[model samples]
Target: MDVKNKVVIVTGAGSGIGKAIAIHFAKHGAKVVVSDINLESAQKVVDEIVTNFGEALPIKANVAVFKEVENLVQHTVANFGKLDVIVNNAGIGPHLLRTHESTLRDWDRVISVNQTGVFYCMKVALQQFLEQGYGNIVNIASLAGLKASPNNISYSASKFAVVGMTKSAAMEYATKNIRINAVCPGYTESALLTQLINAKPEMDAILKSVIPMKRYGKAEEIADAVVWLASENTKFITGQTITLDGGTSL
Candidate 1:
C-alpha cells in the first residue's frame, strides 16, 4: 500500500495525466510499467524515468485490444514478479457533436476504447489481484460521468459506464483486499484541452469563468490525487470517484 517498490502499471502513460501518474509513482520509489498505444511515446517516458533513477518498463499496448491488455499484465508480472497497482487511464473523447449528428461508428469507437478497454484492463488485473490477495486500481473517468454535457454524448455515456463498473467491481472485491476507484478530471490542462483552446481562443475565457477556481487543473495535480488513492494513505477508500475538476462539479 505504501507503493514504495511496488509494481505498478499505468496505461495511456505516453502523455497527459497518465504520464504524470507514472512519473509520480516512479519518483516515489515504485517500479512502474509504462504502457501506451504509442510505443515511442511510452519509451520516452520510460527513458525519462530511468534517467531520474526510477524503475520503469515501457510496453506498447492498446487497451481496446483484450489480448494486448493481458499481455501487458503478463509481461509486468513476468518482469517484476507481481503487480500491486494498475491505472486504467487509456481513453478517447469523441469529437464534439450533437447526438442527432453523431454516427453509430462514433459511438462504437468511443465505447470500445473508453468503456470496453477499461473492462479488459480491470478484468485482467483483477485476476492477478485475486491471486495475490491484494491490489489497487485507479480508473481515469471524466466529469461527464457525473454530469451530462451537451455535444459529448458518446464520451459521457462511456465514462458513466466506467463509474458504474468501478463501483460494481469494488463491491465484489471489498472483502478480498482489492480496492477500485476512479478519478474524474474536468477541463484539465492537457494536450487535448490545449488543442481545443487553441482552436477557439474565445472559449478559453468561457472555460475559466465556469470553473470556481478560475483555472484549469495541472496534470501533476490530478497525479497527486491518483497517487494518494493508490497509496496506503487511503486504505479505507474504495469504490469512489475522486473528481479533480477545480471545483467545477461543485
Candidate 2:
C-alpha cells in the first residue's frame, strides 16, 4: 500500500525487467531488497537506488532454492523490520526448443526457476504475512503463459503455471489480507529476447506480428504496472494477472 517506508524484496534484480522494477519501486519511496543470483549485479541496482537517495539492500539469493528463499525473507524482515511486498521476478526462459527436441534437464530447469521458484519465494513471504496479517506478492509471468509459443514449450508451461499459482494463492489469502497477482510481459528487448531474435529472425518477426501494437514492450512499461499493482493504488486487487504484453494475448 503506502510504500513510503515499506520493505519490498525483488528477486532477479540483476538486469532487464527485474532491474527496472527494483529501480521504480525504490524511486517511489519503497525500501527495496535487491536480490539476484549474481551479487554484483544486484548490488549495482542497489547502488543506483541508494545513490539517488532511496533505501536498498543487495542480497544474493537463488530463489529456486528453498533455504535461500527462506533466508532471503528472513534477512529482508530483519533489515527493514517489516515486510510489505515481494516481487518474485527471478526466472529463466532459456528453453528455445520444440517439445520433442527438449531434454528433461531443460524442462526441469525452466520449471524450477520460473514456476517453483515463485512458489518458494511466496511460501516464505506468505509465512511472514500470516504472522503479521498483511503482505502483497507480484509475480512476473509472460505473454507466453496466456498463449502457446510452439518452440518454447518449457518456458510457456512455466509461465502458465505461474499464472495458475498466482490465482490460487490470491483466492486462498484474499480473506487474510494477502494479495497475490501476476504481470505477464510480451517480448521485450532484454538479453534473453535479443538472443532469441538473433538466432531466429523469421520467428522473431512472427512473434512481433502477434502483438497488435507491432512493437516490443519496454521494460519500464512493465515496471510501471508492477509498481502500481504493488502500491496502495491497487490494494483491493488480488488473484489477477496484469498483462503488459502489447496486446499480444488479444
Candidate 3:
C-alpha cells in the first residue's frame, strides 16, 4: 500500500466515495488531485487535506467531456511533475426504472458519464503512462456490472462496460507496465444510497435483508480497496474486478 509521493487523480472527488478515495490517498502521502464537476466541493476536500498536512489539489472537470478529462490529466502532471494513478470514480446511479420505463435521456446521461467518461480518463492516462513507462488505474464499477440489476438497465450496462474495458485495457497494456483494475461496490453508504433510501424507505429493509452481512458497505471501505489496487502491493494484479458486496453477490 505504498503510494507515498505518487501523483494520483480521483474524479468526482467532491463527495461520497470519490471524496473518500481522495482523502484516503492523501492520508497515505500521495499527491492527490481532487477532480470534480463542482469546483467548490473539490476545493473543500483539498482544503481539508491541506489542513491535515496532506498534499492535494482541486480541479474542476466534468468527466463526461473528453477535453475536460484530458485537461485534468495534463494539469495534474504539470503540477505534480508526474502521474502515477488515476481513479475513474465519477459515475451516476441508476434511474430506478425498468428497461421499458427508463427514458432515453436517462440512458444517454448515464452512459455518457458512467461509461464514456471512464474511457476518456483511461485513454488519456494510458497515454501518459506510456510516456512515463508505468502507471496504475482503478475504476469504480458496481455490483450491477457483475450481476443483473432489476429496474436499473442503463446503470448496469454502463458499469459492465467499465468492467470489460478494464480487463481489455489491462491485457493490452500488461506488458507495457500499465495496470488496470476495477472495484465493484454494492449498496455503499453514500449520498447516492441515502437518496435512494430516502425516496423509498421500504428499500432500506429490503436491501439489508438480501445481504448476508445485513448492512451496507462504508465509503471508506471502498476507498481502502481502491487505494490498495493503485498501490505497489498489487503490482502483479490487473484486469480484475474486486467485488465488495458483503456477500450480496453470492
Candidate 4:
C-alpha cells in the first residue's frame, strides 16, 4: 500500500470524504492536489497538509465543467511533473423525493455533478494516463447505486451511472495498465448525510436500524479504502465496486 511520492489528485477535497482522502494520501507521502469549487475551502485543506509537513497543492475546479476539469489535470501535472492517480470524489446529493415529485432542475443538478462530473474527470485523467502508460482512478459512488434508493431518484440514478462507468472504463483500459474502481458508501457521517437526516428526522433511526452494524461510517474509513485501492497492493483489482456500508445492503 505504499503510495510514497505519487502525484495524486482528489476532487471536492475541501470537506467530508474528499478531505479525508486528500489528507490520508498526503500522510502516506503522496503529492496531493486538493481540488474543490471553493478555492478557500481547498486552500484550507492544503494548509492543513502543509502544516503536517505533507505535500499538497490547492486547485479550484467545478467537475461539471469540461474546461475546469481539463485545467485541473493540467495544473496538477504542471505542478507535480506527472500524474499518478485521480480520485473522483466530487458529488452532490439531491433532495429526497420520489420520481414523480422530483423536479427537472434538481435532477439535472445531481446528474451534472455526480454523473457527468465523474465522466469529465475520468476522461481528462485517462488522457493523461494514456500518455504516461499507467494510472489509477477511484470513484466515490453510493450504496444507493447497487440497491434501490426509494424517494431519491436523482442521486440513485447518478450513482448507478458511476458504478457502470467505473466498470466500463476499467475494462477499456485494463490492458493499458490503467485501473478504475469505485466505492459505494452507505449512510456515512458527512454533511450530506446530516442534511438528509435534518430533512427527515425519522431517517436517523430508520437508516441505522437497517444496517447490521447499527452505526454510520466515518469519513476516514472511506478514505482508508480509497487509499488501499489506489495503492500497489490492489494493483490487480479493477472494475469492482467495494461497498463500505455496514451490512445495510445485506
lDDT of 2 by residue, 150-230 (tens): 889888998999999999999899999899999998888687798787888786778778779999999899899999898
The residue pairs in collision within model 4 are none
Model 4 earns a TM-score of 0.99
lDDT of 4 by residue, 179-248 (tens): 9999999989998999999999998999999999999999999999999999999989999999999999
Candidate order by lDDT, decreasing, is 4, 3, 1, 2
Cand. 1 Cα-lDDT: 0.93
Q: What lDDT is reached at residue 197 by model 3? A: 90
Top lDDT prediction, candidate number = 4
lDDT for predicted candidate 3 compared with the true structure: 0.95
| Clashes by residue pair, model 3 | none
Q: Lowest-lDDT window of 10 residues in candidate 2?
A: 1-10
18-96 in candidate 3: lDDT tens per residue?
Answer: 9999999999999999999999999999999999999999999999999999999999989989999999999987678
Minimal lDDT window, size 10, model 4: 90-99
TM-score of each: 0.97, 0.97, 0.99, 0.99
What stretches of model 2 exceed 4 Å from their correct place? none
Q: Pairing residues by index, what is the TM-score of model 2?
A: 0.97
